[model samples]
Target chain A: MTLHIAVLVVLLGLFFVLPAYHVGAFSRIMVLAIYAMGYNLLFGYTGLLSLGHAMFFAAGMYGFGLTVNLFGFSVAPAFLTGIIAAAALALIVGYLALRTAGVAFMIVTLMFAQTVYLVILYFGEYTRGDEGFVVQQAQRSFAGIDLTGETERYFAALILFAICFLAVAKLVQMPFGKRLVAIRENEERARMLGYDAAKLKLHALIISGAVSGIAGATYGLLFGYVGASFSTVQYSIFPLLWVLLGGAGTTIGPLIGVIFMFYLIDISSGYTDAYLLIAGVALVLLTLFAPLGLVGTLRKRAFPWLP
Target chain B: MLASLEGAVISAILVLTAMGLSIVFGVMRVVNVAHGEFFMLGAVLAWVVTTTLGGHPVFGFVAALIVVPVLVGCIAAGADRLILKRVNYDPDRTIVATIGMLYIIQQATLMTYGPEARPVEAPFNTRLSLPWFEFGDEGFQMIWPWGLSITSYKLFVIFAAIAVLIALWIVLTRTKIGLIMRATQQDSDTAQAFGVPVGKVYSWVFGLGAGLAALGAVLVVPIQQAHYLMGGDPLLLAFIVVIIGGLGSLPGTVIAALLIGMSDGIISVFFSPTLAKIIATFLVAMVLVFRPQGLLGRAPS
Candidate 1:
């Protein structure tokens, strides 16, 4: 664990010190990694494959942006507001969607997420509809730092990502995390064992939503823009791809997956417009040949205690 | 009266598309997320055939109708053998694989056909003004209702959907292949033990399902322009209908399609399209909560 942290620290340090090559781009990846990790909490650890995490993420972005725009809130306060709104949104969506199991759950979440998107698009006055909203400048940062500056934004994203990652790590070691795993493995069995499986799943969903919301807030802050595109069904599926690619149920796997995919898209888009073809083919091939993804594959073949 | 007629047309299209999805889910237990892409491909095929022949629109449309569904069916069958067979129909994994398939097919179309929306000229497009009846002292008065007109091609679509559905019913009930499919759907292992070629049946089912969806696209593309990205909405709508009708229930799927289609048509006509979508999606969520088995769906054992 310490070794992994040591490596992450050095890697982040390089990004911070070295010439700031596309720092915004790297910041985007960090934000996405944070989003993916939040998704992994529900999908990987708790075994709930939600199709509407985008709703939570977008809720965070729009919520935070709205607070800043309307209420004149600063960075951290607006970010908190955005995340709390996302968690609340998750509570409602999850409660409604979790009524059914398996495929029903996936489809229900999908429909609800899409419905939220329609609502957002319909209420264009607030969301700006297709026009989208420009994120207000964060007037204040933590302890006298200027968040509006580009380099400062990168550090803010990096710091938030680390905090969320560590929080996940600590939580997964506790009894609550063990209960989540139990629910994931066999909800029926867990219920038979007297666990409040639904409540536990709900909690996991809220935490996951909150984390994803924070990532969305960070993304809005870093990019200074928010759009309905982020809440699309495509974006909902995007995190699933990242989690699957990284090997679900692992802390480092999502980060690895995000890094690889981010660069994959970045590099491939330069070569051809059909780079999505590669991502598509990769998804099919991976599901067929490498269902466990990078971390799971390594755990099976080499370092067995990877998670 | 015009709204109801339009609703019937919409229901016809929905029935055609959702039946294919229900059949595929029932027999193969794989939700082909790429199913909508087949519909898009069918429309593209229709456009290609129509434009290339460049003679009488009727002649070109006929050629497209005959060739497009079969071609799409073959493609689907090939996909089944190569990809789905390899994946072995694990629901979650198959979902992702089909999403990949969706992106592949969509991008392939975009690359080949370009990103422009292509219009298919209807073979016959004589507009017919619908007559409305109002209750009066004379029991009923035939009155022209506010200049509501429909194209002949749309009427053909309504008839074609019904004919195709009836033919499908005969095939499923009266034909040997249909019997094979139903038996396989009911219990694959049992059917296999009884000398049914379950693998062949699956491929045939997948092809038939895609072919049906393609046929719907072919019928409707003349009215609505065919584009690479147009597959997503139909796919989502079909899934909503299929899920509500209960996965793998043909009659349930058909009924659900009619309900959704009629409502969608009428709502969009009277209210906003976006509101119609919201209502439909909300209904799906409600069904999932209140009655997961759907209107006519059989309960899982």
Candidate 2:
């Protein structure tokens, strides 16, 4: 844990002080890390692989961006609304999704996610469809800090990531977290043990959704853009890959996964336009050979307390 | 009438693809997410062959019809050996693996064919007019519908799908290989005990499923145009059909495809295309909620 904090401090220094640090990329990594953290709670720990978390993420982005851009709301209010919107969406999608299990859940969530994407696209006049929407007032000062300032944006994302990391860490250690694990291990057994598996799964979904929303809002703020693109299956897969690649159920695994993938993509993007092909190949290889992912495999093979 | 005809054409295309998907699901219990990429491959291959031939459209199309599916089947068979076997058809893992395959195929196509949507010239496009009788001031007057006329190619597509499906039915029923496949599908361990080559059967099944998708793509590319991105909609539609129709039931698959096809045609023409998609996607959620076993699937004991 101390090591984790030390790493965070060094990252903060790089973002705030180091001239060589790419704040834009760091900010993106932090935002996605938060998203992956939320995803891990459901997928890694709870063992529910939702292929439609993009809906919640998109909801958060659109909620935050639209509120700030259209309703003239301040940053704090918009941020809260984004999380709320995502949690609320999770409530609806989770309720509907929990009616099924396994593959059905995956397909149902995917279909519903596509539904959301189509809805957003149909309302292109408002959301700007394929072209996407830019938040003109995204640079507006919030809490006496200039959000337009690179360091300020980076710090904002970093602080959010820290809170999320702590929250996920604490949540997984609680009794509720144990219940999530039990459900993941065996839902029928958990149910026989008098635990409400459905309710617990729903709780995990809601928490994950809200965290993803927070990440999405941060992404919009840092980049000043949000669009229907976020609602696609591709976006949902990003977090899944990150969680799986880094290590699901491990708090620091998500950060490691997101950072590693981001850097890999960044470096390779210059060489080939088929960078997505690389990502695809990596996913297949990892799923086939390294199911436990980088951190999970390492912990199992050698270091028990790698995280 | 025209809307329903359009629906039939769409359903024909769907059946060609979804049957392969359903067979894979039935035999291996793996939901191949990259199944749509086969459809894209079919169209791309067809485009390559037809464009390369560059002479009589009929000759070029006929060559594509024969060659594209065989080529796609070989690729899928190779993939099954290389990747699916390693994963051992683990349901969840296969989904991700197939998704990865989807991207690899999509990006490879983008690199090779570029990003442009290309049209394949139809062998023949003779538009036949339909006569409609309307009561005017003088009474019943016969008039030919203008845009209601459809090219003969669409009719050929519907007929072609029917023929292929019939051939598939025959192969599954009359052939010894079909018996082996059925045995493998029913009980893999027992089939293996009986000296049936389960691995070879799996590769063949995967190839067959991919071939169906390719066949459908080759038939439809004349109307829809060929693009690397065109596979997504067909893939999603195939999933809905396979799920709703009952994953291993070929008859059920055809029935559900027809239902969705007709509805897609009527709804998109009268309402809006987006509305049709919304309703269809929404229906999938409902189907999962109320009837997870699907329409024709046997209930689990």
Candidate 3:
């Protein structure tokens, strides 16, 4: 817990010390890390590999985006609406998807996400189809504080990240989180021990979805744009890649993964237009040499007390 | 009637693409997310070959039909040897690796091919008018209907797919190679114990799977323009077909392809294309929820 707080303190200090460009980048990475963290909840701890998490992220984004854009809802209510939308989506998706396991689960989530994407496109009048609408600068304020200001946005993102980070850290140490890990390790054995695997998984998914929703809502609110691109299969894959890279089942792995990936792309984009090529090659290499990921490898080799 | 014809064409292409995915999945037990990229590569390579040949469209088309699949097969085999083999084909690792491969292939194509959708001229695109049968007072009269014609190339594609599928069926059931493949698929460790080169077989199967996707793309390029992004839809549709058909079942893949392709065509006639896709995607999810093993797939042991 002291280590976690120290890490937060360092992040807080970095905002003051770092240049403008990096501060902005750090803000974005912190928000995305939250998404990756949410993904890690189910994928890392629960051992459920979903290929359609973008829907939850989009659920929050579009929920917040649509409510604010269409209904003229304020930021606070719109954010709540976004989280609610994602949780609801997670409920429906989880109910249907949980019926299948393994590769079927992956495929089911993928198809559902595709359906959600298509539905968004079908209602182009509201969504503007592929070209998304932007939230007005005037409407994006929380309790009279302007979120568009760089310093304010960075602090806002940091606060949200700290809350989620600490909550997830605390949650994983509890029995419920341990049970989730137990399910991940061996679902059959966990069930035999009288734990309701189905209900546990459902609850995990909902919490995962709701957290992802919060990230999604915060991302749109802070960045001031909501687009359908967030719901693509590519987007779904991002968290998986991040979780895998950082170290699954680790509290801080998602942050590390997001920071590494964000910068890898950011740095590579300076040299070439095909920056994703670098990401692709990095993934292949990571799988080849470091399949356990950075934090995973660290835990294996050096620090056994990483969490 | 027109919808059915269009559906048949789509089914023909889908069968080839999905069969490749199914075969690889059945034998290797790994999903190649890069399969569609292979399909896109086939069309792109076909374009490059045709543009360079600078002769009759037929010559380039035939050469591409013969060469692109082989070329793509080699690439896929190389990838298997380099990356997949190193990972030991662990399912999760394979997925991540293939997704990496997907990005690599897509980005490379984007860099080289650019974003424009390029067309490959059909070797033979003469429209063949169809005669519709009418039951009237005159009794059993045949009338030629306007705009109810298909390009000869489309008919050729249908025939070619049938021939390939038949050839595939024979190779899988009647030949020694087929027996060895089946043996490997049934139990790789046992097959290896029996002196089968399982590693070599894996490489070959990956190549063959990719070759089949390439073949499908080659055939479809003239009907639909060759674009780097064209692979996405086919990949999704192939996944739906493969799952609906019961994973790696060949016959099931074909039947499901037909069902999906036909329904997609028919649905588009009544609903907007996006709406049709929405319905199809939702239905597939429900099907998986209800029957995870799929229509013809055996229950997991």
Candidate 4:
């Protein structure tokens, strides 16, 4: 318990202080962490690997963008609308995709996400296509308070991240989470045990979709722009990497992985033009040496005391 | 009329890439996400040999078709021995690992080649013209038989792709190594128990897949320029093909590839490219929902 509190304190302190030195990097880390956490709920806990998570993320961004630019909604309302739209999209996609498990599920989700990406890419009129949608001013105000400043947005993101993290943690401990775990471990056995595997998967996917949508909304709001690139297959794959690198089953793993990966990319980009190469090398090394991920390694080494 | 030929040409290219992808997936149960990267690598190497070394483009392409696969195949063999060998039969971990490999290879290519599209001119540019027919304000010109008006290069691509597919079919059906591969794919553990070197077979299978992808790249480079990011478009299409055909069924993959390629080509020609992709993707999702084992894939026993 003391360890958990201490860790949280250290994390929160780092989050608040890091922006002082590098605001952009810090924001990137937070947003990615949020995204990874959302992914963690579906992949790490629920045992459903969704390769097209970017669909929900992009849906949220587009939802928010459309609401703000087209409908003239306020930032808060637009954000809510984005979440709702993402949830709806997730429900539909999940319904069809969750029918298959493992590789098929991964490919199906990826196909859908890529389709969305292509749609956005070719339909230049509505999405502004490849050129992307830009926010003219970052000075989004909520109830007349300027929420556009970096510090304000950063704090807002942090608060939202915390809430999302807590929500996911809670969901994982619930009955549905247990069913998800059962399905992950052995679908046949779970079905024999009388659990509706598809329904459980759907539930988990919806939650996953909602969380990913929130992450996308936060990303758009923070960056003050959104584009088709956000919906690409690569973007969809990032959270999966984060979940894997962090140790999928653990609550803190995704967050830890996100922070580590974001920093790795940020730091490596400065040294070499081949940031992707460095990151890829790191991933290969991690997968080869530490399949269980960094958190798993740490837990094995340091905390033999906990479950 | 010309559009139909263009569609046929594009379909042929897609079929070639998809066939290699399908065979690899069928034999190895490994969804080599890096397959497209191998294709791109072949194109890049071919471009280098032809343009940088001042070699004949055709010879360079042929060299790439032979060499790139051997090189990538060796790397894939290493991947099999060092990485995939460990995660054998664990589909989830394998998928994750392959995705990791995909990113690594993609980035490595980008680092080596830079993120730019380099044009590799085809060795030949012979267009065949037939008797012209008059249309409203335009003359309907026929270039080839069956109302198909396609460039000679495209015709070459079609013939080459068909030849490769037929050759692959023969190899898979007739050869001793092919027999072993079939046995291994059917049941790796059983095959190993029966004295087949499953490890060697796996290495060979990985190499074979990489080689096929490289061959496709050699064939395709003229159509689409050799670019660092060239693999992405084809990779998505290949994935769709693989899913539609069934995960590990080569014939199924071929059929799915043709179906998807033709539909995608036709749709892109008639409607918006975006809508075509959406339709194709919708088909995949529908297939998954209705036939999770795929069009020809058998359910895991």
Index of the highest-lDDT prediction: 3
Candidate 3: lDDT of A217? 96
TM-score of chain B of 3: 0.98
Candidate achieving higher TM-score, 1 or 3: 3
> DockQ: which candidate is best?
3
- Cα lDDT of all candidates, in order? 0.87, 0.89, 0.94, 0.77
Q: List model 4 lDDT by residue over B1-301, tens digit each.
A: 5765666666677777777677677777777787788778777877776676566777766666667767767877788787777876467777767777777777787777888898877878677754545553556653335553456888888788888889888888999878998999888889999999988988888877877777778777787888887887788788777777887778888787777766665677777766776777777778877798788888878
Q: Count clashing residue pairs in model 3.
A: 0
Chain B TM-score, structure 1: 0.95
Reference-based lDDT, residue A221, model 1: 77
Docking class of 2: medium
lDDT of 2 by residue, A1-307 (tens): 6767886898788775656357778887899999999999999999999899899899899888888888888888988899999999999999999898888899999988899999888888788886898877544568777776677778888898998988888899899999999999999999999998989999999999999999888888777889898999999899999998999888888999999899888998899888898889889899889999999999999999765
Q: Give DockQ for candidates 1 onward, in order.
A: 0.74, 0.77, 0.78, 0.57
For candidate 4, what is the total of clashing residue pairs? 0
Greater-lDDT candidate between 2 and 4: 2
**Residues A117-210, candidate 3, lDDT per residue (tens digit)?**
9999999999987888899999999899999999999999999999999999999999999999999999999999999999999999999999
Off by over 4 Å in 2: A16-21, B130-148
Off by over 4 Å in 4: A1-8, A15-19, A136-139, A304-307, B52-58, B130-149, B296-301
lDDT of 3 by residue, B1-301 (tens): 9889988999999999999999999999989999999999999999999999969999999999999999999999999999999999988789889999999999899998998999999999999999999997999899999979999999999999999999999999999999999999999999999999999999999999999999999999999998878889889889899989998899999999999989886788899988988998999999899998888999879
lDDT string, candidate 1, A162-236, tens digits? 888888888887999999999999999999999999999999999999999998888887778888889998889
How many clashing residue pairs appear in each of the predictions shown? 0, 1, 0, 0
Ranking by DockQ: 3, 2, 1, 4
